[model samples]
Structure formats: structure tokens, C-alpha cells
Target: MSVTPARTGARPARWPTGVGRLVAGAALLTAVALLPWLSGTDPALTVLRALSADQDPTPAQLAAVREQLGLDEGPFSHLVHWLGGLPRGDAGTSWVSGEPVLPQVASAFAVSLTLMLGALAVTVAVAALVSARTLYLGSRRRLHRVRAGTGAAVLAALPKFLLASLLATVCGVWLDWFPSSGWEGPQSMVLPALALGVPSGAVIGGLLDQALPAAFNEPWARTWCAYGFPSGLTARNALRRTLAGVLPQLLPTVVALVGGAVAVEKIFNIPGLGRLALDAAMAQDLPPLQTATLFLVLLGVTAGRLLQALRHALLGPALRDGALATLHQPALPRRRSPRRVAALCAAALLTLVVAGLLRDPLHVDTAARLMPPSAAHPLGTDSLGRDLLARLGHGALRTAGVALAVTAVSAAAGLLVGLTARVGAGLTEVASTLPAVLAGLLTTAVTGPSVWGAACAVCLVAWTPYAAQAAALLEEERASGHLLASVSFGAGPRYLLRHHLLPAVLPALLRNALLRLPTTVLVLASLGFLGLGEQPPTPEWGRLLSENQPYGELAPWTVLAPAGALVLLSVLAVSATPSGRSGTRRSGAAS
Candidate 1:
């Protein structure tokens, strides 16, 4: 009998490196410098207001400020001037404070960095514990894995802002165990770090949980197991190999943490770079915003490089030997009745919408303010005396509707680009590093905060993930034997694509889109929570949470109602994931 040798050292996805990386970084910086012009806000007017909010300066005064700030030149000139001062450690001056931008940016960056590090540590710890628990349950307890996965998905669905609100209310205000707000000491950091880290850790844990089992199922692993090797030794080797495949996901998780920190910092009142950027954007302070953007971009680049180095270190000899398994698609657990769960969640959401439509979301009763749940108010009443049930129900339609629209548009655009464009990977990599919150800041800069601005900001980067997935699928399909055979039989490019590619790629992309719905909702909510979405009198899920946060201790139901709705929506999305067979196929192709 002939034995087939194992495929060793599966190579990870490649990203821009060396000179290419430098070019990418430079291009991003240039774009950042041009943001003032892109925003279309008059810098002189903005500066005048920042300098003296009540003063209405004359054209001559505006011109003087303009000339003093070197705004007489084009946007490109700003980039050149900023670049010229970099070597000497100059980062220009802040328009709002008139202080050195570098010092302010540095101080904010340090605080944000500390928060990020703490969050990362929390992420690592959570992922490790979850993964360890799931692995301990073993394959025989498939039901346990399903429950664990559901828990993780639910946890991952919890938005940082919502979590921050809950932690502040329960742990900080009610229990008085920790400080609810401010950056006074280490205790204040706990809530924000947990809020950011727990959800992210759940995501990472899910990835690890999926990857580890897949790695163990490899032929080499089975062979070792059959040879009487200690289970622990074999498990350790499988884990090392799994890490090599899972490292790529760290980039997205890191980006999420950074993006989430915006709301987290806001909620905690921490002076992080995210809050600094947000404040600068709100005030139209270009210098500080630009500097903060620069720092964030640098941090992302640094993270990417470090992850690459770690991947290399983990793979080592296996990289050359092809012993490591390629990254696998995480399969949805099969034993559980996800369809039933999805159906229930959907019905519940629809009921909320229908019930809300019958009620008056805008009606306010000052006498009934902060009323607890009763027959009159199914959920409760907010501080404003508005019915929580009505607001949640009505807000569901707006939040879910906008999220669906954005996801559909993003998926369609991504599919088109991924199937046709060769640069999909590069674009995805670049866009993945940019948080939607930051994009919202940019959009707000131009469009002036509104629902459409938040939607537009989300659309900017949401499509990249779909595009990357489609591109990978296309590449895999092109290399398939069946595709080559069809080509040899005189199949035209149009025929090949229409008959072969679209059918094969569309379902998976759609499924991917569905899985991403919760994330979309969360991002949109994050924007609303930050006051970048719909203005007052508008009942957005995020805005509701934000507006009621102050009263969380007094009337916890006000916050819980919206938070619960979001959690249910997330569950609905996760429960709708397709079966494992498709995931297995995708993983096989990827390998």
C-alpha cells in the first residue's frame, strides 16, 4: 500500500511588506493630512470659534488666522509642512488648545495605549479560559461546545458601550465596588477594559475553539495520536499549529478594540486618543485630529508587523516544511437547533416592531417619569417619561432596517469588486485597520452629524470584508480542476463566471453577510451612543442607551431594555448561521 505524505507548513496570507508597507503608510498619512480640505469646513472660521467661541471675526481677522496657520497653501502643502517637521519631533499645534499637538497627542495616546493593553490582556485571558474549557469538554460533549459557542456569540454581540453602561451601573454605582467614571486610578480602568475585552475575547476564543479542533483532525495529528503519544503533547503541538492560522484574525480584533475604545473611553470619561480624536472632530480641530489619526495609523501598522513576526516565530520550521494547517473557516455548531432559535428571536423582534407601531414613541408624560414596569408600560418609562417598550419597539425598526440596508449594499459592492478587482486584498488590509468610529468622525466632519453620515461611514469600510472573502473564493474556484476542465472545453470568461463563480460564491457571501449583521448593528449603535447618529427626539437603540445611561442607577430598566433588544438581535443573527458543511468546504478550499 502506498502512503500519502502529509501536507506540511501551510502558508498564511501575505500582506504588503518592506517598501510596499512604507508606501501604504505614506499614502494613509497623506490622506489624513488632506482631511481638513475633505471636510470642507473653513479652517479659519473653525479656529476663530475655537479661539473665542462668542467672537465673530471679520474677513481680515479670519485671513490673519488663516495666514498665521499657513492655510493660504493647498491641502498638499499641509502634508508637506507636517512631514517637514517630523524628524525634529514637531507635530504642529492644536487649534482648540493652542498647545503643542505632539504633547497632547502623546499624553492621550499613552492613556489609550494603556487601556488598549489592559483590554488586550483581558482578551487573551478570556480567550484562553474559554478555549481551555471547551477543549476540556472534548469532542464527545458536542452539545457543550454548542452551548459554549452560543454563549461566546452572545457575549461577542454585546457592544462595548452597552457593556460599559451595565458595568458602571451594577459594579460601579449600585455595588460601589469601582469608580463609575473618570481616570483617577487603576480601579477606574476595570470597567472600560472589561467592556472592550470581553466581547473581543469571545470572538478570539470562538476562532481558537474552531481552529484547534480542525487542527487536531489533521492526518499528522491522528497519526501521532495513534502512535500512543501523550494526549497533552499532541494537543500542545496542535495548539501551536492552530495559533499560526489564528494570528491573522488578531488584526481585525485589534481594530475592533481600538474602534470600540471610542465609546468605551467616552462612557468611562477616560482621556484616551479615541476621545481626543472624537473631541477634535466635533470641534473641527484639524491639527489634533490629524495628529491623533497619525498615531492610530502608526499603532495599527506596528500591530500588523508584530503579528507577522509572531506568526513567523510560531511556524518556524513548519513554515518551510508545510506541516502547519492553513486557517479554517469557523463552523457553526450543528447539533443545536439554531434555526428554531433564529425563528424565535425574529418573531420576538417583529412583535416589538408591531407593538411599537401601535404606541406613541414620542409621547412624553412628565408625571409618569421613571415609572417602573407595569401594565401601562411593558418595559418601563425613561427619565423623560417616554415608554421604554414603545421606544425600543420603534427603535428596532430604525436600527435593524438601517443595518440591513447597509449590510446589503456593502455585500453587493464587495462581491462585485472581489470578483473583478485584483487589488481586493490590499484594499481590505488597509481598510480593516481603520475603525468605523474614526470613519464616522471623518463623515461627520463633512456631512455634519446625522443618520446618513453614520450609515455612509459604515458603508465605507464594511464592504472590505466581503470583498476579501469573495476574492479568496474566486481565486480558489479559478484553481479548481473542474474550472480548468471547463476552460479547456472552450468555456468563455463570462460563461465561467456566470455559471461557476457566482453560484459558488453568492451563498457563502450571503451567509457571511448575515453573520456580520450584529457587528453592523453594534457599529451603528456605537455611533449613536457617541451622538453621531440621529439627533434628539429620535429613538435609536444606541441613542436610547446613551440618553438613559445617567439614570441607569435610578432606573436600570431604562438601559437594560435597549441593551436586551440589541443582545436579542445579535442572537438572531448568530443563530441564523448556515450549517457546518459549507464552512468545512470553505476551509478545505482555503487550505
Candidate 2:
């Protein structure tokens, strides 16, 4: 048995180092310097408006405040002043609270770090247990694998906000097992941790499951078995190899964790950096917002680099030398069976959208109020007697539209950025480190709170990861033998990109977009949950959940309808991921 040979081509040059680093540093500084104006509103006016309580401030008063705060000196001057003090642990003063930005961010960061640690511990514990049971202890059973895979996919796809709400409802509202919203004690961390960690664990478990088969069937396994090696030793080595293969991919989970933290902090009402950032954005508090955003970006980049280095150290030469091998590996193909199931799920969603479009969502029928599931209303009626089925249907359409818009913007942006320049790629990775929820909040501040604003906010931070992935994929394709050959045969950049690179890049982009859709839905829902997204009267899933909160006990179905729809949509998206079919195909090919 033979594996495919590595592609023969020069690797693309790594991102700029010496002078390039200086240039990127200068570029980043420039962007940060302009953050005030880029926020879409006049920062000085935003601050002054918030400050004026009883009546609108006069132009004279605004000018006086601007002079008092040094806003009259321009952004460059302010940026230089702030940067000069940054090394001394000074981060200016918050425009809203008038508190020092550094201390405020520090306090919030402490809370965030605690929550992140708790969540990471839970994720590790869960992933370890899953790997043990599925890989080491259990026999290779198809039913067990299928069952576990299905369960993980569902959990992984469930939005953080949805999960957080359910936990809060049960533990805080119903049984009173935990405080739904606070930063009281170690116990307070438990619920938020579970809300975030559960999904992350499922993701890790899925990755482990996908990698184990190949690891177990490696040539070393054959050699060990022939010599009657100890089962424990063989299992240990296989698990180690499996982990080595999965570790590079695992770094991105940190970004997801950061993203989920925003939702967790909001739902649980923890005083973490996520919450602080939200408040700052809502109030247009540029000082705190800038500091917090900068801090978050630094945290993400530092952590990713550290993790990548650790993985490289652990795997040593194999990791360092596998670039071309990884690139040359056959592109994972989808099995037709799973593809059909995914298609059916998509069709069901389309049917709902069609029905929703044909129905009037706002039509009120008081006589049918609070009716449980019946022939007339498949999902029953809400407290206002508005059709729950219609609401759910319409909400699905709205939510789907938002998700598609986000995915489209992010994917297209990512593809262009990834393909064009290495500097852009680096910047994207830095930006990707910011949490999804945090991104939405900041964007809301810049764009103002509205549907398109929320979309723009999401698009800003959401595109980074996709761009980073696209860049990687594009680089790999460029280095592949055929594309490299085309280059050598005098093919121009435009023609090569159009005919060769685009085809290869599109599939990966599509797969990544699908993988990102569930998260995008969750982020949109999280924004609405926080009252920053689609407001009332709009039939969006998050808003629906918010509207039905008051009558949760009396009409569980109202809450259940939209919540169930979100879950179903998420499950469909997850099931449609390349993993659903690609794993099956890979396994078949391996056998």
C-alpha cells in the first residue's frame, strides 16, 4: 500500500519578517489610530450626547467638552499620547464612566480569565473522557461511532445563547440550583462554563473520533501487533499520534471559546471583559472600547502563537515537515448518502421559508391565544394570539437570511484577503482572535444598533477566520504541482487564479462557510438577546425567544417553538458539514 507523494513545488514565502514587520506594525498602529472615525459616528459627539442628561448640549458646550478631553487635538495626537502611556500601564480614561481604562479592563479581564479557565477545564475533561471511552476502551462498533458522532454534531451546532438560556431557565428560574446572572463565587462559574464547555467538548470529541481510525491503522500499529506488543502501549502510541494530528486544528477552538464567552458572560451576567466591552460599545465609550479591543486582539494572537509553538515542539520534525504532505493529501469528498440527508434537511428549511413568505406573521387572532399545538396552528399560538407556526417560519427565514448574509460577506472577504496578500492574512488572524460577540458589540457602536448594523458588526470580525483559512488553502493550492506547473508555463496570475486556484479554493470556502453558519446564527441570536439586534415586532429567532420569556411557564411551546427551530437549523447545518460525509469517505478509503 502506497500513500500519495508530496507535491513538488516551492512553498510560498512566509509572511513578511524584518521590514515587513515594521510596516505591519505601522499599519496596525494607523488602524488603531483611526478607530474613532471608523466607528461610524463622531466620537466626540457620541460622548457629549451621552453626557447630556436633561437636555441636548449646545454646540458651545460640546466644543468646551471636546477641548477639555483633548478631542480638539485630532486622533493622531490622542493616539500618540495614549501609546506613550501604554507602556506605563496607562490606557486613558473611559468616556462614559470617567474611570481609568486600564484598571477597568484589568478587572474585567480577571473575571474573563476565570471563566475561560473553568470552561477550558471542562472542555478538557469531557474530551478526555470521550477519547478514552471511544478510542481506548470500547470495541470498534459502527453503531456506537454513529451514535456518538450524531450526538456530538448536534451539541457542537447548538448555539451558545440558546444553551445558556435553557440553563438559566432551569437552574435559575425553575429549580433555583444556581444564580442565573452574577459573579458571586466559584459556583457562579459552573453554569457559564458548562454552557461554553459542552459545545467545545463535543467539537473536540468529533475531531478525536475522526482522527482515531487513521492513527490506529498506521504502519506502526501493524508492526506492534505482529510483535504481540502490549495493548496499553499500542493504544497510548495511537492516541498520541491522533492527538498530534488534531492539535493544529485545536488552536482555533480557543477563538470559538472567546466567541462563546461573550454570550456566556451576557446570559450569566458575569462582569467579564466581554460584558465590559459590550457596555463600552453601547455607551460609545471609546477609551475603554479601544483598550478592550486591543487587549482582546493581543490575547488571541499570543495564545494562538504559543499553542502553535507548543504543538510544533511536541510533534517535532513530523509537524514541521508535513506541510507539503498535508497539502498533497487527497481532498476529502462527501459520500452521497449523507449528502442526500443534508439535502433533505435543506429542503425542509426551504419549504418553511416558502410557507413563511406566503403567510402574514403579524396577524393577530386574540381568540386563539395561547392555544397548544393543534390542526390550525401546528406550533400553536403565542400570548398575543399571533401564529406561532408563522412566527417560527418567518423567524427561520429571517435568521437564515442573516446567517447567509454573514457567511457570504465573511467567505467572500476571506477569499479575497487570503488570496491577495500575506499581510492581510496576518491581520485577519489577529482580528479573528476577537470574540464574535465582542465584535458584534463593537460594530454596533460603530454602525449604530440596527439589523444592517448588526450584520456589519458580525461581518467585520467574522471574516477573519474564514480569511485565514482561505489564505492557507490558497497557499497550498498555489504550491501544488499542477498550479506551480501552470505558473512555470507562463500562466499569468489572473488566469491561474481564475482557472486553477478558484476551483480549489471554492470547495474549502464553501465547507468553511457551512461550518461557520451555526456559529453565525448563534452570534446574531446573542446580539438580539442582548437587545442590540432585531427589535420586537420582527420575527427573528432571538427576538422571538426574548418576547416569549415573560410567559415561559404558562406557554412553554412559545419558547420551545423558536428554540427548537434554532436547534433544528443548527443540527442541519452541522450535519451538512464536510465532516459528515468526508469522514465516511476517508474511512472507506482507508479500509
Point to the candidate with the largest TM-score.
Answer: 1
Tens-digit lDDT string for candidate 2 (324-371)? 232123332222235555666678777766766677789998898889
For residue 347, give model 1's deviation from the true position in Å. Answer: 3.3
Can you give the TM-score per candidate against the true fold? 0.82, 0.78
**Which residues of candidate 1, in runs, are more than 4 Å off?**
1-27, 138-148, 173-176, 184-186, 210-213, 216-229, 312-334, 408-429, 445-448, 463-516, 529-531, 581-591
Off by over 4 Å in 2: 1-8, 17-45, 48-52, 126-148, 207-252, 255-260, 321-358, 365-372, 412-425, 441-453, 467-512, 528-536, 546-554, 576-591
Query: Please, what are the lDDT tens digits per residue for candidate 1 over residues 486-547?
Result: 55567777787787678656765665576567678778877776767777788888778778
lDDT of each: 0.69, 0.64
lDDT, model 1, position 112 = 80
Error of 2 at 233 (Å): 5.3
